[model samples]
Structures are given as structure tokens and as C-alpha cells.
Target: MYDWSALPRGARASLSVAGLVMAASFLGFGALVRSLEVGLLPGLATTVFIWALPGQVVALDMLASGANLLAMALAVTLTAVRLLPMVVLVMSKVRLEGARRWPLYALSHFVAVTIWRIAEDGIDEVDRPQRLPWLTGLGLALMSSMLVMTSIGYHLAQSLPPLLAACLVFLTPSFFFISLFANAKFRMDYIAIAAGALIGPLCHQYYPEFDLLAGGLIGCTIAYLIGRAGRKRSK
Candidate 1:
């Protein structure tokens, strides 16, 4: 029973910003699938279903390498494990108490980095009754635009220069880093970012396959322990 007649100005603004960033990022992703030789249907499926650029990239890489479907699935699943906590945290903040949980479960599919970050930063401006709609609108806007962009990228992949196409794919990471720096508000944020940045490269140099998952878990664990120790000292 949420209001749907008119969107708040804040929600509209949030949706616009998020939509633009996501569209730009996914435009590159779409081009990537084309370059990777993954068909447009599979590419669109990944964008609509996976909705995780990193995971989608990994899937594309694994597919290119001729990895078996089962193996690729497992790898992508592992890469996506980080989203679990993000979904839980956001849902906790925005869901109405006593509401049916089914819709929340469906909405969790939209809890990728862009939606999570946008919702985290802007949900405060949205009334509780309107929060879900705001997120849904933002996510759908990004998804639909991304679908079109992916097709464009796929077709342009052949005519585009290698360097230029690669640059296009770089948009997501750039946006992610910018958002990370902008939205970070806690000491733990800095610690986690620093730890992950340092550890991730080292892990990539050593173990390319497991690097992302391992680095994320190790970095976050270190950040949590440090924060806990600091809290104890303060007390």
C-alpha cells in the first residue's frame, strides 16, 4: 500500500543520478559482451538477472576461457556473495514492519552496487512508505536503459577500437570508486577500502581466480576486528 501517484523531488533527483551512472556503466558492459562474443540475449539476461557488473564480467571472462557452465556458475556465485550483506542491510533500513516479505525478496534482486549505494545515500530523503517505490523506479530505469545500451555496445564492439572499448568498460569501476569515496562516513569504511585495495592487487597477482572473494572477506574481517578493538579501547 505505498503511494505511487507522484514521486518526491528527492527521489526523482536520486533516480536521475543513479540512472545516468548505471546506464553509462552498463553501456560498456553491453559492448563487452559483444566483444566477448556472447550473444545479445545472454548479455541482456546477465544484465537483467545478474545485475552485477563485476559478476557479469567474471562470467563473460570465464565463458571466453571455455570454462564449463557449472564452473562459471560457481565462480559467479562466489563473486556475488558480497551482495548478501548489502541486500540485508538495505532491506533492514527500508522495509516496513508487518508488510508481506515476498515483495522484499523480489526487490532484493535489484540490490547491486548502484542501487545499494544510491538507496543508502538517498533513502533518508524518501518517506518510509515511498522508499520501496523509489528504489524500484531507480532500478528499473537503470535496467531498461542498460538493456538498450548493451545492444548498442554489442553492435559497436566490432567497429570500436580495442582501447576505446576497454575504456568504456572502465566506467563502472570509476563510478564505483567515486561513489565509495563520496558515501563513506565511518572509520571502518576507510579501513576496509584501504585493506581491500592493498590486498586485492596482491591477491590478483598471486591467485587471480579467488582474489576477489578472498580479498573482500579478509579486508572486511580486518576492518571489523580493528573497529572492535578501537571500541573496546574507547570504553
Candidate 2:
């Protein structure tokens, strides 16, 4: 039997609002999988393997649409490209000096937005040597909850109202923004968030194909330039 008490602080922290929100968001994905007539196993596999909601959704949609394997792969790759920067940020935080490379590589798979956010919020409190273990535990705990919730949502999809099921998918980003605002430590962070909020829709309206990429690039660049100027003035 597993010793629940022995779980790391990061794992224990998973018993919070972040975990619940992640589970809820994935529950909607599970419903989507079922509604698409995809089997539960494939849905659970996406949670375990892809481990990113955007990629999972894209793959499922493509699969349902009977897209060719190469096209599906390319589409999923594009959707997941956004994760590269996130992975870099989280790895920088949790990587130990002179630590073995393989474990960090394994840990990189768990660096989804929710995990990254939780790590950002709590990782500083953990000792360096324990950081990897703490992150491992946290990732596993969250993943386990997601797996269970996904299954539950799959089973419940038939009874769930279509509108309610669709709304559930928004829970993760809603929680993410709330947490981002709560934990934002710099003016630039807020500015970036505001800029993205204002610019994203405008880009979507005019440049629908590359709205996210364009919005993020433009918004963050503007925020970064302003932040740099502020720092120069302060000095």
C-alpha cells in the first residue's frame, strides 16, 4: 500500500482548487471524446500520452474527421508547439545543477500549463534536491485525478447536457487566469495579460488562421518593450 503521508508537498498541494479545475476541464474533454464516438481507451490514452488538452482535442477532432495520419500528426504538432516555451520555463525551475539528464527529460512530459502554474506557485518552498521528486509526485497526482475524472466524464457524457458539457471545457483557462492575476508579481505580467485579452480577439477577427500566434507575439513584444523601458527609468 502506498503511504499517503509520504507524498511530497507538491503532491499534497494537488488537493487544491487547481487540481479540481484541471479534472473538471478534462472531464469535458472526456465528454467530447465520447460524443465524437471515439472509444474511452483512446481518450484516456490522450490524457496519458499527449498530456496536453489542446493537442488531445486536435488529435481527436482530426481522427473523427478521418484526416490522414500525416495531417493529424502535423496538426497535433502545431497545436503542441506552444508547449515548448512552457517546458523550457518549468525545466529551468526544477532542474538541479549537474543532475542526470534522463529524469529531467521524463519530467518534461508533465510540464503542462496547470503543472507549470502549480510549480511556479509552490516550487520555491521546496528544497532543491527534493524539487524533482516533489514535481514528480505532483504531476502523478494531478494526472491520476485527470485519468479518473476523464473516465467518469466519459461514462456520464450521455446524461450530461450539451451546453453544460461544452462550458466545462472553459474551466481550466478560467482558473489559469484567476491564478495568474493572483500570483502576478510584475507589472509586465499584468500588461501582457491585458494586451493578450484585448489583442487576441482582434487578431481572431482579422487574421483567423494565425490569431493565437500573432496575438501572443505582438502583445508580449509590446509588454516586453514597455517593461524594459520601465526598468531603464528605474535604474
Which runs of model 2 end up more than 4 angstroms from their true locations? 1-7, 161-163, 169-235
Q: Tell me each candidate's TM-score.
A: 0.75, 0.71
Error of 2 at 34 (Å): 1.7
Error of 2 at 92 (Å): 1.3
Clash counts per candidate, in order, are: 0, 0
lDDT of 2 by residue, 1-235 (tens): 1122334666787888878778788787777788778789988989999999878876776677677787677667866876788888888887767667777888888888787877778778767777777787888888888899889888777777777766654554565568668757778888888997889789979965455556667888999899889889999
**Which tens-of-lDDT digit does each residue in 82-152 have in candidate 1?**
79988988897778887767768877888887778777777887788777766766666666777898888
- Cα error, residue 151 of model 2, in Å, equals 0.8
